[model samples]
Target chain A: MNFLESIKVAVNCILQNKMRSILTMLGIIIGIGSVVAIVSVMQGGQQEMNKTLEKFGTNRLIIQLNWNEWDKITSRDYLTEGDIQAVREMGEDIVAVSPLINYGSTAKVGKEKEDLLIYGVSPEHILIENIEMVKGRFINDDDYKSKRAVIVIDEKLADKLFEEEEAVGKQIVITAGSQNNTVTICGIIKAQDSALGSIMEGNRSTVYMPITTVNKMFYDDYLYAMSVKVADSDKIDEVGQKIIDLLHRRHRNENKYIMQNLTQAIEQVNQFTSTFTLIIAVIAGISLFVGGIGIMNIMLVSVTERTREIGIRKSLGANRNDILIQFLIEAVIISLIGGILGMLLGISVAYMISSLAKWPPVFSIGNIILSFAITTMIGIIFGVYPAYKAAKLDPIEALRFE
Target chain B: MIKTKNLTKIYKNGSIEVKALVDVNLHIENGEFVAIMGPSGSGKSTLMNILGCLDRVTSGSYVLDGVDVSTMGDRELARIRNRKIGFVFQSFNLLPRITALHNVELPMIYSGISARKRRKKAELALEKVGLADRMHHKPNELSGGQRQRVAIARALVNNPAIILADEPTGNLDSHSGEEIMAIFQRLNKEGATIVLVTHERDIALHTRRIISFRDGSLVKDEPVTKPVDAVDMMAKLSDMKDKHNI
Candidate 1:
């Protein structure tokens, strides 16, 4: 018989027992569903992590002073101007370095006063931290060298202060413990929107001022943290090590500084998610394996149950191959249907999970195709034995079967 | 036309072998309606199985229409069965899930006939069996007589060389059995060859010839002095019932 005719027979058989067919499909559905769901969650989590990492700058490394007990007493474990200059001459690895100093300050603009974060950064901080401007310009080297009292306010702070009008070129007053410094709002950076960005920016409004101006106003030459940008992502760890080594040697201690980079963490995160996906896929695969056995069992039962019908078919001139193909196609159709249902359920489940986790969920066509292929393979692998048994049945014996 | 020479069948399981048939020689000309009658386990069913191409003879040669098929392989025998032989069973053997029309179309489906043509042939066959009005009903929805008619339609739709029936009326009431016999009689009169296996002497009397078997051996082969007209017989029985009511 032609394939279409055999498929029709198979489909008709399945339709005859709608409840049995659906029940037979449940195992495959769950197997494919869980696999797809886990893959989706892991894929979404990975993508979300990549975005967060990219938002925070994957090539940027943070260098912090890890003060020893002796150094803590004297408060002498910090990078100085001479160390920054030395690191600048290191290599292409150190593309740019931004010295950051954070402090809490009260800001007043036309009778509006609220606590805001005071930031001390160089002009290169704009590139290192992926900071985008909404309006006006960032602090230049001229402002830092001349000790100009200039600051950049984010759009949120601008909206808070001006309510509707622009805050560019406006005077912003920063008072920290009675030390007040009036600085011009030289630039307005775009406000953060993503959850990670919002958390990074925090509830406190942020205002950026030149490092020279902050150092003069705070009366301290010490730095809080330094943001180091690497030219190549692959060379981030090597470059970070070189900078740390230089600083350690220069300071005459090996444990005085700590370095953190997004590149290193990305590998760990990628490894974790891939392993997590693998583990979940394995668990789901076990269920699918059980499902395959279920198919085989049901197909055997079906062959036995329909033995007389098979005999009737054989008497009607069905070749061994015809009967085999009919049953094989029935199994394939069952699993394929289950696979389709599983994928839909899995995607919806993945979407729900990602939404609950507040992560961006992504769907891919490759995984859906993979699920289909796997389900079909499962159908064939499990279908062969039962079909063979049916084909080998003797016409007389089968016709006599009850 | 059917011919068998010393056709023997031995069914073996482990060390024990049962000789279901032994050197049974038989022949029936084209357009002949023949019946093989025996008690249960008398080798008649085995002879039918071999003649229908559902089984192979353990020894000797059997020829049908011009081809020797005694030693044919499973695949070849299946093809022969499809193209050259039709089988009717005691239980009607109609697939319960499908309509009568589809059941009738089953044989043609495996023979690679186009669906439209198959449907047409099946409808004609159903009409021949007097099941034209019940074509859309499933076996479960059909009476035993109607189901047997569907089986007969399925048998005829293939247009095979010989119709082989094993107890075709064994499960039916006398009236339904008479109806089934009447259809077979009609087909035989239309030049169809038929070979049937049955245990009923009355049923065997309806055929043109009777071949009796006992203890795995052919005991008798004789032409009927006068074959019963099944259609006339059924009509007479109904008329007798009308007379009894009066």
Candidate 2:
């Protein structure tokens, strides 16, 4: 018989035993469902990680003095503007270097005070951090050269301190240690909105002033750390090592500084995700294998139950090939239906979990197509033996069967 | 036309062999009505199986409608069975799940006939067997005789060379049996070739000739001097039934 006719016959037979057919398809459904769900969730998590890492700045490296030996540290171990100039003159790979000093202080307007974490940076900090401005402008060379009492604040702090009034061009008094100074708000930078960004920043209001201003007003100009931006990110670690070596030589000290970059962090996250994906894939494979076996077992039972029908058809005019095709089509249709249901289940589960965990949900056409192909292959692979057994039945014996 | 030369069938069960049919030579022409009569295990059913191409002979030749099918392979034998022979079994083997129309269409389906033409031919065959109104009923919904009629419609839908009935009336009541026999007789009168197997002498009397098998061999083959007309017999049965009711 033709393929369409065989499929029709198969469908009729399956419909005649509705519960049995669905039971046979259950293994495939669970198998494909877990695979799709796990894969989609993992992809969504990886995408979010990559986005956060990219925002953290891939090409930026932080060089910091090791503070564990604070009692043994000397004044000569501190990084200086001379060291920053030396590193900038080292090679073309170095984009910009700027000192970064953080201090916890309080800002005041009249008698009202709000706690703030203040950062002292140079003009190049804008390039290294990719800071986007909302109004006014970032710290410039002119502000650093003249030691202008000007500062930049984030939009959140601007909204909090000045309320509806513009915070830019306004002055806020800051108290640091036992020293206090008045600084004008030169600009307002955009606030971070990502889940990871918010967690890292917490509720601390942030304000940025020129390093010279902070060194002159708050403390002595003994730098503890510096941020460097490299042009070719592929060699970021190597360039970081070169700069550290140069600093250690210039300061005439050993093991006093360390370098950190985002590339290594990115690699660690990738490794973890890939390992998890591999484990999940193995589990999904086992499920599919078990499901395929279930289909085979059910198909064998169906073939045996329909032996008399096979005999009748054979006696009428059906060849072995006809009988084989009929049963094979039935098995394939069952698994395919299961696969479709499983994919839908997987997608919904992924979305549900994403919403609960606050990760982006991703669905790809390639994955759906792959699932279809795998299910079809599973059907053909598991169905052959049962269909062959049915086809090989002797017409006389089959007809004689009760 | 059907012919068998030195037809022999042996059943082998491990070390033991049962000779079902031995040295059976038979011939029946086109438009002939014949009956094969024998007791159980007399090799009559074996001969029927060989004639239907459901089994192969051990050491003999059989030709149906001018095709030498004794040595044919399983595939070629299946084709021969599809195109040349129609079988009506004692159990009225209509597929229980499908309607009578689809059961009649089964043979044409295997023969690769289009759906529209198969439906038309199945309907026509069912009409011929006087089951046109019951065409959509499942087998369990029909009486035993109507189911046999449906089986007969399925058998003849493809217009095969011969109709082989192995005790087609065996499952029915006397009235239904007579009705089945009358249909066979009418078909025979319309230039169709028919071969029936029955142990009942009354059923054999309706055919023009009788072939009797004994112990794996054909012992007798003779034409009936006077054949009983099944239509007349059925009419007599109904008349007697009516009188008894009164």
Candidate 3:
């Protein structure tokens, strides 16, 4: 008659066969549980990737020489000092422009000589890439103005060279082309731990020198690539486009260089992660479908088993609505219980996996609510037909059934 | 009051139509105690089913309390059955899992009575049938006689106008069957109309009248000269209990 009484009747019916009810609920539990766990793991992984990407200065725009159409011209031979000045003049929000000239050579500190890449860059290189100084000061404008041969080394490279002794302000010999040069270490950058930060760390091991000195010593006029920093992160794309146009006019060719925005890289990663999450959700949804079928099967069996009970109730004036409500409520209770238990199990598993593997596990309230709604819908959709059949049974025929 | 004119029930099985009730006309007034006696497959059970609203008559005009029940829909028929008639079955049909009290309270539940009031009424019904002490017992825990008593209490819980019983004592021992018949006789004396179906002529002798059926038709309808009073037997038993103190 009332909602509470109907629920009571449904609960009593379920409790009448505890083992059967539990066994039926197990299908739904596994279906919902696996879905939540997989999605959480994927979400955690995406967050971890975003964190790593953020470490590399999401606003930092890389202006590398584009060789997509001009395959004959290499990135290492195309960029020049004149291009850097033209990009700087485009806007005041253009905070820093560091021209890069890279050379692979052997570096000798004391008797330990290691083959490493040497980067000839300006003082603004540290600011643009968001690199942190671990031990000593970064190379300053005074060092670049005087054409000072100063360098910064990562913690790993510093350890290799100094071996427990301080390496700052010490000379390390670099043999590039036919000329051998000795550069003083200005600072030691920290070793990066996360995946994206480690990429910058690997780049940090190079010897840094004044762009003027590199132009004078190496190619007399060449620049390889440039990294730029913008004042406002929101205006990165506009600033990047201005730099590209300025470079195109200065170089007299738009196809020679490419502007790679860090924002686009982050967007790509987001898209990839979202698609992956959707795929996992669809796979998990299949299990819920199977669980729905299982509920239908179990409900059918229940209707058949309780035919006589139906007859007795019908003869006692229980109407079709009563019978339908009773069976439908039984189904919903089973699924709702399974869904709650599944959510707990899934979240716990996701937490455990993330903690054990050191991965980011994302738990969003939206996903939890969506999963719950879907499971309950599955229960109602699957439970209706069997309940209808039970309600429509002929009381005489049902009573006659053994 | 009940009246059926030319009642016919044909059960179709594929291409074959079996006439379960054939051209039966019967009239039962208020507070009448009538027993329908027949052998197996004689359509006495079919007649009981139609009278109980568990089955539809193939062709008939049956009126209960002046309402044309034969043409009513399933839902309306269910309502009528709930408000006006109670049923007792050969198998007892008590929900096995619930206590005797809950089984008796079930019909009142469908009537939308409050739980507290339903419990009180159910207790009174059980006490009326002398099962007050065994209110909490399940069907399995009760003996045959006690189970039938519980069923009778259940039937009386709604205070329906008519009690339709199809072989109510079929599964009981002779003593339990007599005990059940005694309860029925008392219920009849309390002005409830009753129609009982039985193959045993001795069980039929407890009612005021007997209606015999054969080949899906009523063959005879006659009054019994000496009907048994079940409440008198109960009173005599209590008297014997007082006298057997030696």
Can you give the TM-score per candidate against the true fold?
0.92, 0.89, 0.78
Error of 2 at B16 (Å): 1.4
How well does candidate 1 score on lDDT at residue B7?
A: 89
lDDT of 2 by residue, A1-402 (tens): 878888888889889888988888888888888889888987887777766666666699999898887787889999999988998899899998899888888988877678787888999888888678999999899999999999898887787788899788999999878878888999999876454454455556777889898888876778989999999998898999999899999988988888878778768878987888888888888988888998899999999889989988988989889899899999898899889989988988998988875776777889999999999999999999999999999988888888
For candidate 1, list the clashing residue pairs, or say none: none
* Candidates, DockQ: 0.84, 0.71, 0.53
Fnat of candidate 3 is 0.63
Predicted structure with the largest lDDT when compared to the true one: 2
Clashing pairs for predicted structure model 3, backbone only: A44-A360, A66-A257
lDDT of 3: 0.83
Worst 10 residues of 1 chain B by lDDT: B126-135
User: How much DockQ does model 2 earn?
Assistant: 0.71
Ordered by lDDT, highest first, the candidates read: 2, 1, 3
Q: What stretches of model 1 exceed 4 Å from their correct place?
A: A15-19, A67-74, A103-119, A132-134, A146-167, A170-184, A189-207, A212-221
Looking at model 3, give its docking quality level. Answer: medium
Q: Score residue B2 of candidate 1 by CA lDDT.
A: 91
What order do candidates take by DockQ, descending?
1, 2, 3
Per-residue lDDT for B134-159 in model 2, tens only?
99999999999999999999989889
lDDT of 3 by residue, A1-402 (tens): 446666887788788888887778776788788878878887776676676666556678888777576566755447777778877776678888898767667788778888676667788887776577888887788987887777777788889988899989899888768888888888988765564443544534555567766666676666667888889999988888788777777666656667787678778877987887788667677877777888888889989999999999999998898889888877888788778888888888888887765775778899889878987887799999999999999999888889
Ranked by TM-score, the better of candidates 1 and 2 is: 1
lDDT per residue, candidate 1, B204-225, as tens digits? 9999899999999999999999
